[model samples]
Target: MSTFQAPKGTYDLIPPHSATYLAVRDAIAAPVRRAGYGYVETPGFENVELFARGVGESTDIVTKEMYAFETKGGDRLALRPEGTASVLRAALQAGLHKGGNLPVKLWYSGSYYRYERPQKGRYRHFSQVGAEAIGAEDPALDAELVILAHDAYRSLGLRGFRILLNSLGDAKCRPVYRAALQEFLRGLDLDEDTRHRIDVNPLRVLDDKRPAVRSQLADAPLFRDHLCEDCRAYHAQVRELLTAAGIAFEDDPTLVRGLDYYTRTTFEFVHDGLGSQSAVGGGGRYDGLSEMIGGPALPSVGWALGVDRTVLALEAEGITLELPASTDVYAVPLGEEARQVLFAQVTELRRAGVATDLAYGGKGLKNAMKSANRSGARLALVAGERDLAEGLVQLKDLTSGEQRPVALDALVDEVRKALD
Candidate 1:
């Protein structure tokens, strides 16, 4: 019989390599954790209407990409394509917003599902570290999230990514720009679907990448030009803050990231080395998302750093993370008596805060020694009836190829001392 494998467009994180992924996740979440953003977790799936209403019906994520289904009980649900809507939903449901904190800062890390043709850096299921500052709208708050994300990438030795910044205007001025943009798009020689998209959300047409669509949009209306005074000032403050912090950014007039909740500031992190799927991650201010999701008015800003994409970015830059050894010691037991003795010592070493592994299956010394070497351990413990009878065990330094004897009673202390 053939063995079953993981479904297509998915992957399993195995040892050695999986360590790098963990380190990447830690590096991305570090800055957010230090900034007082408490961790938040939501179910893999939520009401399908959450994305439909909060992510916007006009988005491809809602119209196409999302993994939605009806439960056996007849409730409509979806595996979240992104984080903001669900995070905000959780905060509101738990009354976290009702707390004294104006913008209830929260961070999340999880796998989000979307059904799409998987490619390098794009997956049917992907992992992300997301941060949200809900219930407030301040340029400084917006600037802070961007700065934190910038610091995150830098912390991991990533320098090839660029921050693409823009403002989508707000309710006060977006309708005017939308109408003008709609008029401009309606005049183009577009397909039926493209023409219909202009009526639903004209800004989306700006994101069209086809050469034919791009040629016509050359003179299209820009959000930067239509920004109301308030939005302009808000965007200017965010830019100034970023500039003052020595973070460089490009003003992308047409970056309407694949979301509908974004209003005012919208920014994306693009790594030039990643090609085509250059967006490592992005997020922006969602001032109306709370109301759209049936919560009280709460203006928010957030960003999610793609763990998988960031790992790819690290590779694209030819950088490898410094990951610590998983096993500090490997125990080799030659005989049944020695096995029991070494097994207890292994437990003792572990209890003393030492990372220890045991060579199982009664392998011979040569084979067990090979196992120890493969474990990336600094030390290998070997014992037989003779060594144990003498109240001693062989502690071999794998790095230096030096062997020594230590009293069985003092084993843990000796291992700790050697490791330190």
Candidate 2:
């Protein structure tokens, strides 16, 4: 082995297994595309202040987990810890919100970095397929995002996952609840850092996972009880829309997403099969994020599904994705002349939309056939010097162990027919 390794908390997705990752991402993204969310991509890193302001400076993501650094030119940049801020920043900079239709819908998939202690389902470097609908405040948009996410998981055959729903009160009522929560938190016996979070973001205290913190929080004030009329109405409409769509969800009063900008509807998708890192993916409506990031008041809703964690959930559920073979035809060429002839035919087959692989390095018939079997190709194309002289090749059905001679000129058509 080489004396090198992927950085701690990161993984290399290689080979046959990587196919599953791609399939998962596609499954998650399909529904959003069907719903008219156009695809968007952005740089993996962005100006540090964008996240600090948009994702919340008080949250652990900015304060501790963000992989922040100063550039040689004195510009501070951070690898994106999440997708929303960068996506919104890009949308704002490109004036999509101003030029396009309201609720500029978008979908993105890529890696996000965080400097956290790694655990199962919680990697420092992870992949996500995300969707965003910017510039709309309709609760239908919120329900659409949630329904799309749920549909994605189900499409991947993921079961036993629950969508936890909550509404973090909007600007008018959140402060009142924050003060009451801080008052209760301050009177409890807590560590200094936990106490400090109370002042910086009292809502975060409710999300603490430790039993000690969670136990004390049992009596804490909830945002549902304090939501202003507008926020309450907004939350009710979102729930109604979800119910109308036949999407089931549990009301989670404690689901204060680890972001400060979530104004009304917030949600998390959890699976008990994932152990402590139970959250497979989660996101919520960040109606105030655009203004916080120096853009106009564009209300938006979105969600991100973890690609790696979804693969884990699939494994936990004993579900296997029915992935197609990487190669449809494996060509085993027998002599130098036959190799040259079959290589051209292989190229033609590939051009005809057949997934084809050729045996290289002049492997023997046995070894070449072995390689063909290993490739999971359905058919093996074999041509010896004698066969090439006869202007023909042998097409072997690897599955049924049947072989037949076909005209070399008609090879491409034969392979296409077999594959179809």
Candidate 3:
């Protein structure tokens, strides 16, 4: 028989490596929870049109990257390529934004699938920790989302990250900018696909990395220059709020987010140390997303941080997170009677909130002690038949290798005190 491994571009997080993934997740979620954002979970897949309309039909994600398929019942579905669209769909479906609260604050952490040509830091499937503040259109809300993302990155001890901010302009001014940008793009001697992109989403033309296109784009129309009065005022307030909160950012006119739904304020967190796959995570104001998906005119702003890319960025910076110990106490029992007695004792320890684990199989004392050390346990509880007969259990401080006998009744308390 042959054994098949995890599919290419997909990874199985196991053992000590899985520990890092969990640590990263907890670190990112801690600040979000403290910010009064409740956790929300949606289905892994939704109707294909949900993304095609919500994420924008013109963006590469909906057109190329999505893992979409037809169901046996003939319904078209797609594994969510990102979290925000699904989250918004659920919030709208549940009527969370029906004037109950101004902004329905939500934070979610989960896996997202994107069928791309997998490369370093880019995969077929990945996980993300995203947050959305829907139902509000205030500029301070945009600043708050940026602050939350910055806090998440700082909490992970990450440096070398630059927050790039831009305004994609609202419906009031974006149409004018789009026409001017398309006219310039049409005059260039571009490939058929590049020309097609101009008709689909001219702003994505700025996102192209090709040297020739970039050289020609230097003369492209700037969005900041064409912003209408309302968009200009909104952009000014968002910058002011960010300044008041001591969050540093760079205003790049060329920073066009990939998705079509994004409008007005757009931002991205980029890490220079991660090589070409430098975009750790980013998001922006999707003011028209609700209406685009056949819902009411609900405007919102949010961001999604890539957990996998953030981890790689941390690694690239040589930052190591000190993972908590897996076991607080390793209870090793010798002989059958002591095993049964210690099993009961460990249960009590666990009830007292002490992390305790015991040897699964009957290994020798030497082998068992080795397991204790490997678990990163601070204390090892040793119980033998002779010690049990005397109503005593031995406690060995793994760090000091000092062994002492304690009364069975005092075992839990003694271990707790020793740990402290």
Go through the candidates in order and give the clash count of each. Answer: 0, 0, 0
The candidate 2 region of ten consecutive residues with least summed lDDT is 213-222
C-alpha TM-score for every candidate:
0.98, 0.99, 0.98
Model 3, 65-149: lDDT tens digits are: 8999998999999999998889999989999988578788999999999988889999999999999988888998899899988
**Candidate 3 clashes between residue pairs 3 or more apart in a chain or in different chains:** none
Which residue runs does candidate 2 get wrong by more than 4 Å? none
Please identify which of the two predictions, 1 or 2, would achieve the higher TM-score against the true structure. 2
Q: Model 3, stretches more than 4 Å misplaced?
A: none
lDDT of each: 0.93, 0.92, 0.91
lDDT of 2 at 47: 94
List the candidates ranked by TM-score, beginning with the highest. Answer: 2, 1, 3
Residue lDDT tens for model 1, 1-420: 549887888888998889999999999899999999999999999999999999999888899899888889999999999999999999999999887878899999999998888898889989999999998889999999999999999999999999999999999999999989988888899999888898888878898878999999999989999999999999999999999999999999989988888999999999999988899999999999999999999999999989999999999999999899999999999899999999999999899889999999989999999999999999999999999989999999999999999999999999988998
| Models ranked on lDDT | 1, 2, 3
Q: For residues 1-420, write the lDDT of model 2, one tens digit per residue.
A: 979999999999999899999999999999999999999999999999999998899999999999999999999999999999999999998999877689899999999999999988889999999999999989999999999999999998887899999999888998888888888889998999998998889888887888988887777878889889999999999999999999999999989878888879999999999899889999999989998989999999999989998999999999999999999999999899988998999899888889999999989999999999999999999999889889999999999999999999888888888877
Q: In candidate 2, which residue pairs get closer than 3 Å at backbone N, Cα or C atoms, i.e. clash?
A: none
TM-score, cand. 3 vs. native: 0.98
